[model samples]
Target: MPQHHTLYAAFADRIDAVLTALEHEGVLPPGTPRGNVSVEPPRDPAHGDLATNAAMVLAKPAATNPRALAGKIVGHLEKDPLIAGAEIAGPGFINLRLAPGNWTNELHAIAEMGADYGKSGMGEGRRVNIEYVSANPTGPMHMGHCRGAVVGDALASLLEYAGHEVVREYYVNDAGGQVDTLARSAHLRYREALGEDVGAIPEGYYPGDYLVPVGKAAAEEFGDRFQAAPEAEWLPIFRAFAVERMMDMIRADLKLLGIEHDVFSSEAALQAAGKPEAAEAWLRAHDLVYDGVLEAPKGKEPPEDWEPTQLPLFRSTRFGDDQDRPIRKSDGKWTYFGADLAYHMQKAEGADELIDIWGADHAGTVKRIKAAVAALSEGEGKAIPFDVKLVQMVQLLRDGEPAKMSKRSGNFVTIADMVEEVGKDVVRFSMLTRKPEAQMDFDFAKVVEESKDNPVFYVQYAHARISSILRKGAEEGFAPSADNLGLLGEDDMALVKRAAQFPREVEMAARTREPHRIAFYLADLAGDLHAFWNLGNADTQKRFIVAQDAALTGARLFLAARIGQVIRNGLALLGVEAVEEL
Candidate 1:
């Protein structure tokens, strides 16, 4: 059996062929534009199993009215046994009802595919590098960083399932001033660890007590050897030591949310390798950078000493940025954008596409980075796709009130704290319930509540209920097998149609680079399952396991099993568990 049915794709292709035949018969123009043609499940099931606006889309170009063209298309489609009924709807739409055996056959096909059911070849194994949650190596990951982490991870999984070669990467900001602050903070903690009473943490440094352990670890390793050294001598040493420990803490915190990156690219390492300098030289040779002075801002107040000075700058304006961006500071250090450009340059060499997930605060940075990427890829003689998805802030709340800050993570709540409070599953699921760009409140009360209003619980309960039906079927000797699938009726067939949409949902989510759609799709699927199960409660004969009718019960069980399988498949892409019992 094929790994994916793609019934919609198959019918769409057949429709195109029919259109070509219609053209051959001289019924319409020879070459009609088929690009806008779409075959999708009807919004209202009463319309038909599937609907198409092909005639409406092509009618104007073909110089014919929609209903007339739809009639011709329906006439051709009705001749096929696969299409049981094809009728013209309002305007030019053609609604198609497939043979009942098609649904039963698809149910068997889905069961046969198992875990591989929804896997699509849409990505064609193209290399996609996804960089996300590159939080600074300064302290524990806070709640502010949670959304990007979950979104990135889920997007990576979604892409992988869609048949892309995906890389989950973290860009460590260890070369920046943040790590410098972390180093100094750890140095003070080191002093406190070595019998010296370090007073309250310095105002400019990290005040979180989480650094105490790092200071103790540094003292244990070096044994006060650098306690009396000058700041110059110990700053780099402590910076390197502290950055590593901070990353370890970050990784552990991410683990609490079930996130791990395949690569952790270090900004310091990129700088040390002279990658920024190399990128600068390349851009200069290509006339993409020059030593220039930038003008003062027009809309906003400029700095007090806003006089222009000669500095290396990238021609970001060439690719739609508001102004050319400076690549180097007055003190000759590469700016963050400079290093970021180098990093993206290196990524562009191997990756066919690059996706970055950043906090919404960095929204202004998107244009320049995209310009840099466009310039780099333009120089390469090929267009490399690059997108930056900004994840908005997540507000932590308890019982509709703002949650208390975590002392362990300083001023904000930690990812670990959230995970510990709810669970890895709840945290991940809640993060995706909304789009990454929209701010949301992660209410502690709403998430863990066992109610249909809670999407995570609702979806999970559907899977558990399906499992219950199957278990009861097994106990009553009505075990669901693909054998009696033809016995399924209108309700069973409707459920199968919903289940068949899994592959389409995966492809759609992957194409949009939005894993949240998977969550949305699963919720809808769960609702359908719940509604179907409720039907059984209204009529005992509709129950999954009938005490006397083993064959009918087995067919119903078959439908239930496929529903559960598709749910499990969707949840897998979202990195959520499909519980057998809630």
Candidate 2:
């Protein structure tokens, strides 16, 4: 169902074999509804190449003991050319160990596919919008935004690799009151850039020194242009200059982290037809526009005589939201929710699915946004398919000391700054080493430790070690060659089997919306490579780069080359760097 592929076909064949034998022997009653079986490697290597709990699942309906059923299934499987050994393990588990060289065939497949080794087309050409790092344009991105940025970017890459049409988007929060404050702040900097020292920041305005650059640019572009003008005349010009500078800074920040956006949708631009009129009209057409009254703030009080005011509200409660939401304020101004609604609606028009990467604070907002989209679709099949993921806060430390910051331009640490402090590969890989929802603590010392504690290094080492073998083999006159992989030993075959499962691992990551799965799988694959390497350290003849016997050395080097390719391909999917040498 998730796109026909060769490996899945092999799995399907194994399932069918079990089902047919069961039916033929009448252990399974006719029309027993045999489907949904799966084949995966055993948790322990001793169990087998692949393990299926098929017998235990089938035993109840077949009216037979699980072990008995497993025996019968194994009997049928042993005769299959691909199945070298089928053993009935504890509790009716049929552990299928593939034939010799069958596992090695995976190496050849990896070699054949090269960079495309684990790529899959599971999304079936569907369109998806991945909105990420929607950090307010008022400032640079902080370490807090890094996880979501990497996750969203890697997820977009994963989806695109799996045949989804993905739009990498940035929702520029340029229309809000925040920008007004930014304009005022830039005005002060405009004066400062003109040799005026406006010390200390005003309470509600931005305080980063980065804004000084914007003010400098403003003075350069508008020397005495708006000094004597009204707030209205200077606000827009300052606002535009400030936002453009902030965006340029943000873009540089993203590039430093190796993250880039395909589209930047400006919130202010969404108000082309005027936010108040456009949003109200859209809400009115759906009967969602209504009068709304303000409640005295729960903990804070409104001014006395702040009589209940009536205004337009979006009836978001109609579509799974917890409560009706206001879209307009008493002063005939749009609420933050108004521009947000329009922006998502813009996304709905082109995307078959909508995915947003947000921080945990916006968890409550997801339902309302989805509610708006559902209400807009009128509950049709065209209903927006949306999913919002929250990235938990990250704690940064250096050599056991808290990594402290002093307002590094913009309010917090930028993604660019973090990547600059630590390389992009570690930043990309480590962000995903933990589950997205789980709180992650990034340590400067541990990240560059060069031990197994550093996952990026471990994985990169596996690739480089493989390359080292190829270098030694080439020096020994071994022409790169691979043949009769079936002659490979059990340990050699196990590595090949893991290579074959890469696509399945990719699909699992995409389906679960868990990029961490790839991280976990690559780590395990690296472990396997390391295990094989250690075996060579213990047994000289098994060493991949043997100076004696060039033919066997070539064969072993080919296997090492295959591992290197897979590691490179896997890292590329996660947007992590793959270094061939340490």
lDDT of 1 by residue, 246-308 (tens): 999999998888889999999999999999998999899999999999767769899897777
444-543, model 2: which lDDT tens digit per residue? 8899888976788899899888887777776767766875454456677667777777888888888877888888889989999999888988897777
Model 2: how far is 422 from its true place, Å?
Answer: 1.9
RMSD of each candidate relative to the true structure: 1.5, 3.1
What's the distance in Å from true for residue 182, model 2? 0.9
Which pairs clash in model 2?
Answer: 101-486
